[model samples]
Target chain A: MMKIDVSLSKRLGDFDWQARFSAEGGQLGVFGPSGSGKSTLMNLLAGLLKPDSGHIRLDGSPIFESASSINLPPEKRRIGVVFQHAHLFPHMGVRRNLLYGFRRTPANERRIDTNDLIEALNLGPLLDRGVKRLSGGERQRVALGRTLLACPRLILMDEPLTGLDEGLKYQIIPYLKQVFNRFEIPYIFISHSLNEMRLMTDRVLEFAQGEMTGEVSSELLARRGMGTGQGGYSNLMEMGRLREDDGLYIYRWGGQEICLSNGGDQDTGMFEIMSKDITLFKRHPEASSARNMLQCRVVKVFEAGNRIGVELDCHGQRLMSQVVGSAVRDLGLEPGSAIIAVIKASAFRRLY
Target chain B: MFEFSPTDWQAISLSAQVAITATAVSLPFGFMAAYLLVFSRLPGKALLDSLINLPLVLPPVVVGYLLLLSLGSEGWLGAMLAKVGIRIIFTWKAAVIASMVVGFPLLVRSIRIGMEQIDDHLIQASRTLGAHWHDTLLSVILPLSGRAILAGASLMFARSLGEFGATIILAGNIPGVTQTIPLAIYDYTSTPGGDRMALGLCLVSIVLSFGVLVLNEGLVRRFRKGVK
Candidate 1:
């Protein structure tokens, strides 16, 4: 299992950001508010920036140790990063950008095959094209290919999807998933959106004011959101087979199907539905405008401040709904209660 | 109609050689100075920055006077070179040196602007891709700054071609030897009934400057196309 331990501090403008984190194993999702030291942590991990005072270690190697005055440069640390802007060398073609790190890797140490990555990332047509000619989605894919070719022990992605719209984000998510599934190396994915982080990884590190508040499984965070009512919950369902129905697109997941207003013939991917957008009714509302109504059994009902948090099991897939305490009592919602969860087809936001 | 004298031809050829030599020799140093000023965290950086730009702010004759004091036959650098049996004063080499010193700041200023305009993230990306500083400099910074370097070299070359104050003071206007186009033009203008010769050389200077500007633009556009 790969491991990381970092404790660093720096002053930014008027605030002191004390960044600290420790992680082990699977891809870690770093979720935080703006100016919460997420990017600082990434830079520190990648050796782009040194900490004021602390040590950073990866898999037992000392990348940075302030007390010992040991600081390995970014190149020496074998870390790869995909910045928010992609930062592809504008002077280089796609092929050169991808091969830049490949050439730098020692022959015996190189694990990635250039042809395989090019094929996997579908970079064949783009190899000879200049970086400026690529679309945003294509640029991200090329950036991913470039970073992967480096054969880094750790990778850090800083808000890779922040600027992308919903459609473009879905287009890029599979490539990201392919990296984690195919490569054994550990990586930290940073983003401010929980929806984006949820689709990327289960283990998330939430930051606030330059410190990590907690590291929890995505499910637990959603559950916490359900309990608090302040932190709204969302469910990510891994979409399976796909088909077209009239002008709408139908997606199969967990023995049930969800319909989308559009996106027919698109590749299968994951999508998120906000828990607040889902309403629980004791019986099907025959006159509702919501396009999706799944018959589900109430898994649990818990107190959420002045609200009621309902966890439901629909065709073996978990979904959440929040209702006021008065409504919960009026609907007689409780554990093992049967209900129809209503959601709009427009609410099915694809998670690329 | 535009027949030139042997002296005029010799001065034209000497000026071209001196400008090319000055630009060529100073290119690497100017690049390094610009890179350091833009990227390095050296102590007294402000002072270093000011010192690199001193030539642009100071008068050319003043620069030549200082060069004479520091590099004259009896001066410290000249004494050291003299110990090695090398003399630079009142030579064509001195003309090249004078041109280089006067034009150094222009080269540095243009290159520094280019370096400053580069996105730092590109450098960071290269580092994370396992390229060391030298590799990054060669593979990224230099290529991205190609246009600006060309602009700077063109400016320096043009400046060197027209260099008169320093070249006359240090190298002297010796015909067919230390004399360049500008020096020879000065000589022709000062002599009685030499207006035609002076005007011919003046036309040559304008044409040379114009040609350099056109060539620089073409080269910069080609480099940018290759880059994109």
Candidate 2:
């Protein structure tokens, strides 16, 4: 059980930021808009930045206390960070970069085996490669391995998968989950995408301006228009298995089979289907380009500004669809009403 | 036959020794000054900056005169040295001191450029990875700034080889004692039918400076390739 109690105030150029938060968890997600003090809070927690007047404690150890005039340097604070750009040492190869922190830690205190971490992060093949030769995904994987080998009590990741394309995101998410589950240490994953947070954890702390406004579950926040990419909403689904047919991949989900763009080895993970990508049809439309059609019962309908949010139950799985309010009234969508939801194969965003 | 007199050989060897000693002595202090200028937030930073750069804009004769006042036999520091029965004036030590005073700004400028080019995130990343400031300085900053350090050392070494105004005023042109390559060349140029000897010494100075430049470039290339 780890706890973080932060009450700090600092002034940036032309902007003043005040942040206060207390949380205990395995994974806590920090979600806020750009320049809302999320990164500042992370820096403060990592001891890279000092607060003017506050006290910070990690599991009852005083990392920083302004009243007591005590502040530990970042190296002694035992916090590892995975920056947005990885920031691997340019002069070192992948092998040396990973071993940098491992060798620094006391031998008796080392918890992570060097070989095991390399295998887990798939860094064995790229160990001797120079840092300049790594691709974006490969660099991030190395960064994760390096941070893990540090044996830090708490790891803070700042938008680990922000700029990656869709395919790379699918490839990276599984490694993130692998590290998180293997290490018993808690982590703070910071991102603005609610859908991405849903794949990692449900406990999210929301920030606005410079304050912790409230807390909400990932699903509930997604329902409130806090989804991925440009105010979009997505329904994250779990798949059981996949079948290959005619160069297409089919996923068996909710007692039904759905076809997707790619196939992977493990099939038990979440997939994000954007809410706006699904179309409603009164009956099963024939000769359509859409791949999967599921017969779902409307669980609830609510007004979402100019559009309406319709929550559907596909067997036991929940799928959300956003439709124009006029279409809702014309098709008579309500609780217990049965309708067909059509989705394209390209719309399925797999999050391993 | 290109014959060099014993006095000529002495001046060449002495010039080489003085220049090497000046560069070696100023290296650590130059790095410290550059690091503080670029990284630290000293209280009297403006005043310190102007003082460090004063050598660059001032005349070498003036610099030599200031050194004379501070380190000559009658000066305060010179009196302190005299108390210990050590003499620096009109000696090889004074030549080294004058060369160091004239070449210091170039050394500091190149090192400061190198230190400023380093990325701040790399230092922060090192600290987060459990390396203290000392570790970061040794492992990250020093290795990355190697090319600049070499460049600065070479520049100062070449500059000291050609130094004339400061050395003549402080160390004097005493053959076989304090006279260096430039002083030897000056003596030959003033005497009758001494053009040949002066020209030979000038060629020697040119070859030495060219060798240092080539070594500097070669090492910088090797260092960059190693990092890559």
Candidate 3:
């Protein structure tokens, strides 16, 4: 397994960031709000910035260490980086720019073929054209080809698609996927958009307030969560609503309560309960059909918006039910009424 | 109805020889100094920059006086070099040296700006491809800055051709030997009934200046087109 173990702490004017994380060989996406220290972390990894105090190791090889006094310059790091702006040299033709790195590599260590790169990037027609003549997408393609030709151990992409339009972003995302999959080299891709992260990465490291929260599987947030009232009552009740006091949310069911620790998103206090965990009942069933049933009145009903958000009220608490709109109307639910809310014991998960 | 003078032709040849020699001798030094100024974080950088540009601000005659103090026969370097049988005072070589001193600052400044304009990421890209500093400079930096180098060369050549004050001080005005076009024109204008000769040399100087300007423009245009 190719592993990256690094800890970087830096101070830029008034803002400060001290990030630490490790990942095995895979497509690791770094997601955060703007200026959340994503680019700074990448710069540190690429040897462009030296950490105030820490060590960076790639597969046990020391790239940087403050104690040992080992700090490799950017040129010696064997890390390839593609900037947001495709910084191709304007004076050189496309072929010359692409071959610049390839020509510098020692013959014995050079693994990539020049022709293969040209064909793969569809650069034959552009080879003779100067870089200033290339379109934005074309420039990025050449930049990617240039980075690939270098045979880097790790690739760092700093918002490679930030300025492109939606149509162009969609067009280039697939090509990026193909390149990443073909090389199978470890990549730390920086993106602010959650949708792009979902489509492009397998693992995501979230940054907020200058610290890495943790790595999360991309599948965790891929689909919308089933709200409170729509899904089976057992699941909804088990995944409790956000409590205002102490900022801790708890789901209680079947003599068990799970507490959720805060993981940075304090604003827009939203949490997701799984659809499969909710147990729906027709009436106010007593005696134990499920744990934690609320006498909720149906508020507004619509096609659960992704078949998941059915709004309802349970004892002055506004709740969302993830269910088919047909189910809401089938029960003849109307404003200001009473029904039983059944929540499963298992679907209560505390998001971090 | 054509009147041609052998002395006029001799002055033209001498000026051409001095300009060529000045440019040739100073080209490598200009490149090195310019590269250092752009890429190095050395101490006294601002002082060095001001020192290089001193000739452009000071009168050319003052520069000649300084050069003479250091290079003339009883002077520090001149006396030491005399021991090796190398005499530069009042010779054509001394004229070339005078031209070079005046022309160098422009060359270095232009080339240094060109080197600064190169996108630093391009150099980093070369390094990731396993290229060391030397290879990166050779394959990337030099080619990218070729137009700037050309522009600098043209300016240096033009400035060297027009150099008069320093050249006259270090190398005495001698027709067909050390005297260049500018000096020859001055020589003719001072003498009685030499107005036509002075006018001919003036026209030659104007033509040379115009040619260099056109060549510089053409090079810049071609480079811009290549970039596009």
Candidate 4:
């Protein structure tokens, strides 16, 4: 477990930022748009930048405090950073890059075994290859593996997946999830992507301008973001593996079999469907173009901006769907109202 | 066809010795200067930059004269070294010093270019990964700047081989002891009917310098391949 408590302020040119917050261990996220001082916050936490007059602590041990003029260098502070672009040493091979931090750390402080990290990150084949030879996804995995080998108390990722293309970005998520699952090290993920926030972080600290505007859970942040009208509320579902049939992948999701197109036969069966893509019918249509229809009852009706987000319970599984206020009135989307949600086979997008 | 004398052989050997010594001895200092220029936040950096580059802009003869003042017997640095019974004037060592001073700016410039191209995040990543500053320098910065260092060393070595104005002023044109290729060529050119020997030595100078340039080019290519 890890805990972070920081109250810091720094003025860069015309920008003034003051942030104070304390968070306990978990997949915490720093969510903000560009130029919002998120990188500055990361630098301060990693000891890469100094806070003008403030204190920063991890697990109750102070790493920086202006009152006593105590500022530990980044090396002294057991914090690791995975940058947006995988800054693997160009001169070293994958093995050496992975072992760099491990070698520098003392024997006693090292708790993570090298072999386990390599295996968890699936870096075995790429070990002998130079970092430049690896693809974009491969480089990121090596960067993460390298940082994990150092056994840092907390990892601060500054948009680690930003530069990767859409397919490559999500392709690395499972490796990241596997490493974090295999190792219990706490990490603070920083990104501007709300989809990434929902997938990776349980709690999020929102930043706007130069100050931290609010603290929110990832669920609330996702719900609050539904008002943007850009593909409202994405529902993440874990579909159990099944055999492919008739050019479509069949999977078990929420105690119901669902058909998905463009879902390749990868071991990772996680998929996401946008709330806007899910159409609701008061009664099952005798014939429809959409492939999967699941009978659901409205568990809650929450208001997100002008749109209404209908939370549904189907076979003890939760799914979110959004509709206009008029549609909600017409469909009678109240708690305990039975409705069938129609989803096209093409709507299911694989997460990883 | 040319007839070479034993003194010409001495000049040839001495030229290589002086150039090699100057390049080898100046490498560490050059690397540090490049590091300072590229990375350090020290005050008066601009002044240090100008001072190191002064010899590049100044005439070599003027550089030799200034160095003569600094290392002369009556000068402060020379006086301090004189207490240790180490005399450096009018010797092959003086030629080495002259070449080093003249060739330093080129070395530093090449290395600074390489160092500047390195991403700031790589260094930051190293520090956060539990590496000390020096550790990062040796492990990260050093290897990344390696190709540039080789290129710089080769440039300086070639420059030293053809060094004429400063070598003439500082080390003098003694036939065997202090005379190098350039000094010897000067002597041959001045003597009546010695143009053949001067032309022969000029060929040697071209071959030596061209060899260094080719070797440097090959090394840079290999380093780039290794990085890739």
Candidate 5:
């Protein structure tokens, strides 16, 4: 039920910014390419940067307005921001960094307990360790924990995972997901990575050339990436119980079993399969080299660039695949068509 | 080995007193000034930056003369102080003032460099995390720039120890009084057949400056260890 309404404009040299939008905030997203005024939106919302002229409201309260000259300072705004790079105070230990904002908040106003957040962030062991000694993933975790401990009404994360490596990025997403689900804190997740946006956000506001081009659901945003030459859409799956078999990890997803070449001994894991990596066959090929093959019903076929994006239901789980236009015609693919999909064991990339 | 006279010992001790006092007194102002220069988007910032650096570029004698003109009995500040029953000129306090004015730019410069290096996002993060400006300054900016503050203080202290033209002009070369080691050396050189005494004071000056630098280094190493 959290709500945010912003209508602001700013001119930075040649790049002019004009955006007007309102969102019912629950895992809201600001999605765009680089230099698309995404960071501008974040700074404006957080009150880190002033707008040329506009008004911003959160939960029916005007945090900033040009007409009446009511621009709340950042602290008074209570909108926490996680910058691109985790900016933990270098002089403080991990424990102090987490408690910094909590201590600043009034006792009556403070909602989240410090110990609960530390436990959620798994920071017990690192409490006394200085920030300089932490790794990239741990530093980002601390930054997130610190912001959360402040009990912000709305959190603005500007590409928080962009600074970490691919391996570390996936590892941290689970923690982020767990914290958000447990606390249910409204947040506007900002990122250019379509996969990340699809994973972390529910609704996305797309930005291009310093303007909000469109606002769409997170799923449609990922689908839009198909024709942009950034590769086809990615279908992410949250798999249940995990087990290792013959050096391959078998994971349960949508009443289907998936084999992955790489996975750890976690109770549950998330994995992503790109559309391009899935191959559709009319009939089950005998003696196929691919590790896994499943007969799926084609849910839908849509045109994407010169290719066709196929949405398939494999054992009630939705999976996306892409094929050339000629292939779709050759196979006579359409909704309700039973097609066999072959995937390599290495195609499933473990997210956590 | 040089023979130490009681007057020579007094000069050494007095020099220490003046340098330590000047650095200690300037530390807070230097920190504030550096913070303003680094963080504030003031319109007159360029002018303010140049003004702080004026003494650094100007000759010590020129700075001393300016201090004299402004601090003398007939001057505006001097008259204002006179009404309050305060006298600054020709006292050890004047020596401390002279050292402070000469060494202030170095202190501010070192601190400014450190403050500038602190990531702006860190300040923004603290603010967005519900910290007021004062809270951020104390919890984030202050500790982050502590090493630079220490560096600036030590550098200013070393500079103050060598202060000569300004101190002599303002405090005068009165032995066992406002006269420091440098002034004592000046007195020895001007006196007949006092070359050995002048050289002795010069050695003491080198030792004092070296000791300050060594102490600064040791403290910095300990700070680094604590951080890690």
Candidate 6:
């Protein structure tokens, strides 16, 4: 099993970044905001940057140890790195660059099929082309092919898709997923986008303020709050049920009830509630047509740009409401604030 | 009008020999110095850089004078060398030394730029492929920087062909031995009514320079295309 157990502390200007982690052969996605030290961790793992104090072990081999005075150069580490800019050798043709690592592979240990790799990456047409002539997406594809041809023990990618447009990202992400699935070689992918991480990562290490907070199974963590389904606000509408009392209708979710303005025969079955449609109030307001109002307590507050997401525990389930930061502060809302969450009946729609 | 003398042919042959010898002796040193400048993290890099470029700024006659003071017979180091029967003063070998000293900087600077321009990521990728340092240098670095090396060599060859001041200071005017193209041109121009001979030799030098420039341009263009 390919494993990495390394710690590094570096002081760059005003920022002190310290990282330590270990994992075996698996896809590990380093997810964090910009300037959170994700790329620094990858560089340390690749032996591109030496740690101030620590040891790095790859498999059973000691790649680096401060105590033993053993520091393997990047070329000796057998760790492949794909930069955000692709970093292909402009002086060599695509075929030459691809064959560069292949030629270095020892004859006795060489296992890569050059022709098969070329065909698999759709690089046949690009074999003879100059690296400078390839488009952005095309260059990244060739870079991936070049790294793969090396047959490295581990691959480190540093935000490879950060600069690409949406169309290019979409086109290349599927190919990346396919390559990762087909090859058992361990890969450490660094990305900032939640959507991209969800689609590609198997495991995730959350980074904040230059430290790794924790490791979580991408599937499980995503399912809890950010996943495609179950438990989160997006899935709450699916579990929602409508109940009529007198002329008013209430949407019953778990033990809490949200009264809606109208619940006619046209309204049917369980639906989903988008976090965007819900709003929080410091106290109950009188004379309102909106009927789905329930008492809840704030649990967590997350800030992204100009918006703040307020996590609330209503009844026995968690509900998230997106609100403006100004509004959140104006209401003097904190983690323990008792608030009313209002949602219109029209906001809850049945999910097919 | 086109009368050619045997001495002139001998001078041409001597010039070719001196130029080839200078390039052959200096190419390896140029590559090493260039690589060190490009890749090493040694302290006082700027000092070394300035020292390499010192010859470029100094008058060629001054450079030859320094070489003579150090390597000439009866000189400090020269006296020791003379005991070993290695006399360099006023000889054809001195001409090759002069040319090499004059051409070394041009070659090293060009090749250093080439080495510096290489993407470090390619080197890292090569290493991860299980290739050692030697293998990576040969397969990746050398091939990627081939054009720059060629450019350096070509510039050195052309510079060596045209060298004069240092060659004259070290290797005195000796026909069929140390007399190169520039010296031959000087000789013909100094003679009464030998303008035609001097013009013919001048034309040859022009053609050679033109040929090298064209070849350099072609190599660069081809390299650019290959990189793309």
Give the best candidate by DockQ.
Answer: 1
In angstroms, give how far residue A242 of model 6 lies from its true place.
31
Each prediction's TM-score versus the true structure: 0.94, 0.93, 0.75, 0.95, 0.95, 0.74
Q: How close is candidate 2 to the true structure, as a TM-score?
A: 0.93
What proportion of the real contacts between chains A and B does each prediction keep? 0.90, 0.76, 0.69, 0.88, 0.93, 0.76
Candidate 3, DockQ to 2 decimals? 0.50
Off by over 4 Å in 6: A91-96, A107-134, A208-352, B75-87, B192-196, B217-228
**What is the CA-based DockQ of model 6?**
0.43
- When summed lDDT is taken over every stretch of 10 residues in candidate 2 chain B, the lowest stretch is B219-228
Judge the docking of candidate 2 as incorrect, acceptable, medium or high.
Answer: medium
Error of 6 at B143 (Å): 2.7
Give lDDT: candidate 2, residue A208.
83
Candidate 5 backbone collisions, by pair: none
Alpha carbon lDDT at A192, candidate 1: 86
Prediction 1 TM-score vs. true? 0.94
| Leading candidate by TM-score | 4
lDDT of 6 at B100: 93
What's the lDDT of the predicted structure labeled candidate 5? 0.89
Clashes of each: 2, 0, 18, 0, 0, 13
Supply DockQ values for each candidate.
0.87, 0.80, 0.50, 0.83, 0.81, 0.43
Instruction: Give each prediction's root-mean-square deviation over alpha carbons.
Output: 2.5, 2.5, 12.0, 2.0, 2.2, 9.0
lDDT of 4 by residue, A218-266 (tens): 9888888888859999989888768788988888886798888877667
Candidate 1 residue lDDT tens string, B1-228: 567999889999999999999999999999999999999989989999899889888888999988988789879999999999988889999999999999999999988877887889999999999999999999999988988899899989999999998888889889999999988888888999888989999999999999998987787677557544
* Segments of candidate 5 deviating more than 4 angstroms: A229-231, A242-248, B214-228
- Per-residue lDDT for B27 in model 6? 79
TM-score of chain B of 1: 0.95
Report, to 2 decimal places, the DockQ of model 4: 0.83
Look at candidate 1 and give me any clashing residue pairs. Answer: A170-A352, A173-A352
Interface root mean square deviation of every model, in Å?
A: 0.5, 0.7, 2.1, 0.5, 0.8, 2.6
